[model samples]
Target: MLTYYPGKTFLHRLDPTLKVLFAFTISTACFVFANIFVLLGILLFEFLLALSCGLWKWGLRSILGLLKLCALLFVIQILTYGDGDVLLRLYGDWVITFEGAEIGLILTLRITASALPLALMLRVTKPTALANSLYRYLHIPYKYAFAFGMAMRFIPIFAEEMAEIMEAQTARGVELDTRSFFKKIRLLMPLCVPLLLSSVRKIETATISAELRGFGLRKRK
Candidate 1:
């Protein structure tokens, strides 16, 4: 959803090369720092950064798409991580420990911190600008820089294709919605097959379009 928002804010005016470096630096730091307090500060800093760039609302809203997956991941971490004091007892040999819960929260924060700034950068920077900046500032091959831009452009396209596929299946009364989470997961499994085929078709179409446009043959100047 954050596929170039087009604003004249400070971040939008900043050079794409610097923006890429900033995002990479912050995203990488989320993984490198092991302390929960540091992670929280990173997330807090991201929120401030978003506010400063005039992208607080849109940036946060865009990240909502990852919530479901993040929630699942958080749950998995809590279930698997067994250490520290026992916080709760669910059944025989199954308990939620303080360490597990802490770890889960830490991981969830890390992911959120990592994605927030990158998403804001996407909202501010255009793909063409990114490609140009990479080639000029980093001396990356023109084709590879262009490919990176195209890859960013493809994200929302892929998500759109996925939604359309789901809608099409729903029209056929596939009972894709279920109250049970695991049942919903099973229902989504069928969508992957169609999504993969659709992805291949789209990639093929994109390849043909790129070839016709002389994607790799274009000059830097």
Candidate 2:
């Protein structure tokens, strides 16, 4: 499924440079503030922006994915270097410090709070528009920017293809998850071989077609 949703919301109407700057400003502010209230306000702002853009569902999905990363960092922080007064004394001398836990919680919250607005901007904007904006306002090289834009457009297709490959393998009784870690990785060899071979052939065909069409004979203005 495509992660992007096309819409005519205010966010979509805004200049891509401004939208990018807006996300960067919020992210920077979130990193600078240690106060949880300020961070919460940032989160609220992100939610409001997403809602206003009419991408509430898409934004929520992105937020949920972000939450997973936040949870991982929280767990790692709680488990390591937990110092100061013990909140709950677990087995052994391990102690979950109030300061450490508080810092961890704030860090995790800041991460999710910061990620939402960026995700909203990316989800609402088209890659071509974003690249064109960068080339215009940011003075990025047009060829490089367009290539990056094309790469971004291919991400969803690659993800979908991966999912289909996994499902097809599962249907064919490939034990993808039941093997040892190394074995599971080795099993990927079969998948990668075919995908790489097909990709190489496709790339060759595309290159030949472009050469015949005189793609680079004249520099594009």
Top of the candidates by TM-score: 2
RMSD to native, candidate 1: 3.0
Candidate 2 stretches with Cα past 4 Å from truth are 175-221
**TM-score for all predictions?**
0.80, 0.83
Error of 1 at 81 (Å): 3.8
For model 1, what is the alpha-carbon lDDT of residue 182?
80
- Backbone Cα, N, C clashes tallied per candidate: 0, 0
lDDT of 1 by residue, 1-221 (tens): 66777778888899999998999999999999978999879887887877887777865665565555588888998888777799988788888899998888878888888888788788789998999899999999987887888888888888998888878887888776557868767888978998899778987898899899876776757
lDDT of 2 by residue, 1-221 (tens): 23567889898889988999998999989999998898988887787788887867766776677878799899888877567778877778887788778888898888998877777777788988999899889988776776667667776866776667777897898887665867777777789766667666765776678669874575646
Clashing pairs in 2: none
Global local distance difference test of model 1:
0.83
Best by lDDT: 1
